[model samples]
Target: MRLIEKVWFRGHPAKWLLVPLLLPLTLLFYFISALRRALFTVGLKKSVTLTAPVIVVGNIGIGGNGKTPMVIYLVELTRQLGFKPGVISRGYGGNAPHYPYLLKEDTSANIAGDEPVLIHQRCQVPVAVGSNRIASAQLLIEQGCNVIISDDGLQHYRLARALELIVVDAKRLFGNGFLLPAGPLREGRWRLNKSDLVIFNGSPNTELWPRKLTTPNAIMQLTAKVVCNIKTGERITLSTFVQNNPQVNAIAGIGDPQRFFDTLSAQQLCLNNTQSFVDHHAFCLDDFSHFNDNIPLLMTEKDAVKCYGFSQAHWWYLPVDTRFSAIEQQKITELLITKLAV
Candidate 1:
């Protein structure tokens, strides 16, 4: 684990050495963040409210806590409700050939980043990626997208939003509970009180919720049952795949790699070995040269987006879907209809 992650998530004597130095910077980050939000709030700075209503699907803590899957879920839901939804993202780890780049069927994850490409492929919706979300959102507007769902821009006060949906990692609820460098949060817990709804990814231990702020909350679980070969489009039930190939090597480059591995294990896939990488690691073929090719290699769908070009025959990826209870789904649907009036 990285030293900062140790400082934020683990109780280590090493963090005692590191936290003091990072505290000052953490304070500065909080001050600047608060000041920026205040500026937009008091009208000292301009925030562009787009023509189409934007529902931001984001999180307070850094690292992936299933925000991309939530974004994908919303895309499908809005489409069912008869609205054309477009997605905009920061496109971290990707430098597109141009700004306000719209994704095509042939667009590479290396260009638009893995998450956006994954969402586009999963939902078949227009997705725009750029640092300037206003330009990205506007581009979607030009493409006739009536509603916009932002994937991880909760702190970007410049782009006004209609509804804010935050996805929290229920297992790691705000490590250290401090903002930025000293902790995992981009915003503090109080930010949750301001959101339209809070979605806890994975089973929630209700005790972890900060006491008293009533922002209606729900649960989101991921269900994965199919695995597909990356090189070819052949699909197989996870059970069949597991029965056929017992020597599986699982690899994940996500916020919580262990969660992916654990999910695979829970699904009865026996693992010969496991590997984890930093979230959104720009994958290349050289990264896999050290691995044994005889063993079946399994990975998450998010990682597969970046590996399609050089995927080996033994490589496969598990695609997960967001699973919400009937009541929760109805609640979200009602909120979307009322919040966006679509």
Candidate 2:
């Protein structure tokens, strides 16, 4: 294993030795995070209220918990309710330096980030990415978007939100359950209590402390859907793919590659080989040399942004859409309307 991976699994002796010295800094981070939250609660720190309702979909964990899919699903739901929805993101891994730049069709992934671009393309809504989500939300409002959906801004206390939706990776709820350098949690699991709704991307797990989002008239259920290729822009049912092909190459460059692989397996699609890369990895021509011309290459839509200029013909991207029950959709819609009324 690589040195970093080794240290991640087993703490380095040096890391332990520095723990005594790092203790103060770690405490400082915790205090700051807590202070920000307290300020929001006490109204000391002002949260910018948009003219429209703002629904935030985010996670306390450091990595992905199906936030993008949930955001897309919410966008569709809001549209069905006759509301024009706009999206705002921090553009986590983008080169755009502007505070609030409106995303256009020509916006590159490097500038607007892969998620924003994917959301814009799929949802067909106004999208903006910036360092300050509040500023981006304002820009979307100026564009006449009555409902703003934040892609991932749970910990971003600056942006005032009407409704907050927390997504958990049901499969890997909380890795190690420690905070920051200690583990993967960006905030305590108890923070889920503050969210308007808690969504489990995989399976429902209520054994954890705060329990499920089972408040008076809350919604809970597993939302599942199959993946498909984006090259032809058509949905390829998992059942059809599995019945025809026994072995396939699976490529994923998301926060959790294993989740995608496991989902494919659940559909009975046998993966002969798998390649996992860092989240938002850019694929170039050299990266495609591993596969023969005849072999099929499948990847997530996020990875397809970087592969657009490539000449490879076998490469395809699987586009997955989220599905929610009618009751869940109604609850979200009502919450949004309530927030907007304020």
Candidate 3:
């Protein structure tokens, strides 16, 4: 684990040890961020609005809270309602040559960013990435997308949004409620009030959720049932893997690796060992030189995208899908219809 990550997620007294040092810096960040927002609010900075309604699926905290899955779910949901949806992302770690990079299934994670590529592959919709989100959205609009979903752009005030949906990690739930260096929050707790909807990526603990949030909320459960071979694309159910009782090693390079590990454990898959890397860690064959060829290696689908050409036949990745209650689904559909009608 990275040193800062260890300090940030250590919990209790251990985590509190760094607070005194980080607090002053946090206040400075808070002030600067607030000023920026005010600039946009008062029209000193312009927020570009598209011809089509744009919805932003983002988070208040730093790490992932099932945002990509929720974005994919929205893509499918909007399609069912007869709107052509396109996705625009910030492309955080990608090193593309220029702005507004339209992603293809064969696009390298090194160039188009991992999440954007995964969204394109799974959702089969128009996907574009750039630092300038407005330009990216315009590209999607040119592709005939009637609705645009900004995958993680809550902080991008320059892109005007019709609805802002915030996804929270139920377990962490804003993490100490401090901003920037001191805590996980990118914005203040009060910012939740500005959202049109709030969704907990896991079971919600009312005690942990911010009291300031009054928006209608929902819960989503992510489940992984089958693991597919990265090289040959063969799938084996968790039940089948458990029946064989073979030794397996798990690997994850996500914002929260423990969540993936716990999910596997819940499915009764015995993990002989596990390895975790920093989120979006680029992989190479040298990273796996020590592992034996016969032992099966399990990984998350996001990590699988980076390991494509160098992957072994024994290596497999599990794909997870989000599940929402029927009532909640109807509520979202109705809400979208109502918002777009305006």
The parts of candidate 1 lying over 4 Å away from their true place are none
The models' CA-based lDDT, in order, is 0.90, 0.75, 0.86
Alpha carbon deviation, residue 49, candidate 1 (Å): 1.4
Worst 10 residues of 2 by lDDT: 1-10
Better of 1 and 3 by lDDT: 1
User: Top TM-score: which candidate number?
Assistant: 1
Best lDDT among the predictions, by candidate number: 1
Instruction: Give the clashing pairs for model 3.
Output: none
Ranking by TM-score: 1, 3, 2
Distance from true position, residue 339, model 2, in Å?
Answer: 3.0
Candidate 3: give its CA RMSD in angstroms: 1.6
CA lDDT for candidate 2: 0.75
- What TM-scores do the predictions have? 0.97, 0.87, 0.96
Q: For model 3, what is the alpha-carbon lDDT of residue 230? A: 91
Total clashes in model 1, counting residue pairs 3 or more apart in sequence or in different chains: 0
lDDT at residue 251 of model 1 (Cα atoms): 85
